[model samples]
Target: MSKRTTPVVAGEKAGSKRTKAEEPGIRILGPEEFAVLVADLLPTT
Candidate 1:
């Protein structure tokens, strides 16, 4: 069996610091791109 690791939560850590350019977990997708993503995920016969 493989060992499991804890998933880290997003946000700045205690005593940690961030700069103006340090942004995480941000994404923007248009409708057409989202539709393509959904289509790729669908199971094929």
Candidate 2:
């Protein structure tokens, strides 16, 4: 069986001054990463 790895999502901490979306410190997920996140949320039969 193959091993599955979980993707990491990085972002600003709570109560940070750079809470605005226009800030340059934001982290963006690619299409593959986004799909993996969605798959993890789905119910398994």
Number of the top lDDT candidate: 2
| Each prediction's TM-score versus the true structure | 0.41, 0.44
For candidate 1, the per-residue lDDT at 29 reads 46
How well is each residue in 1-45 modelled by candidate 2, as lDDT tens digits? 112323334344533432332254454455677788889999999
- Residue 19 in model 2: lDDT: 38
- State the lDDT of candidate 1 residue by residue for 1-45, as single tens digits: 112322222244312322222235233344566677779999999
- Model 2 bad stretches (over 4 Å): 1-23
Model 1, CA-based lDDT: 0.41
Question: Scored by Cα lDDT, where does model 2 land?
Answer: 0.49
| Clashing residue pairs for model 1 | none
Total clashing pairs in model 1: 0
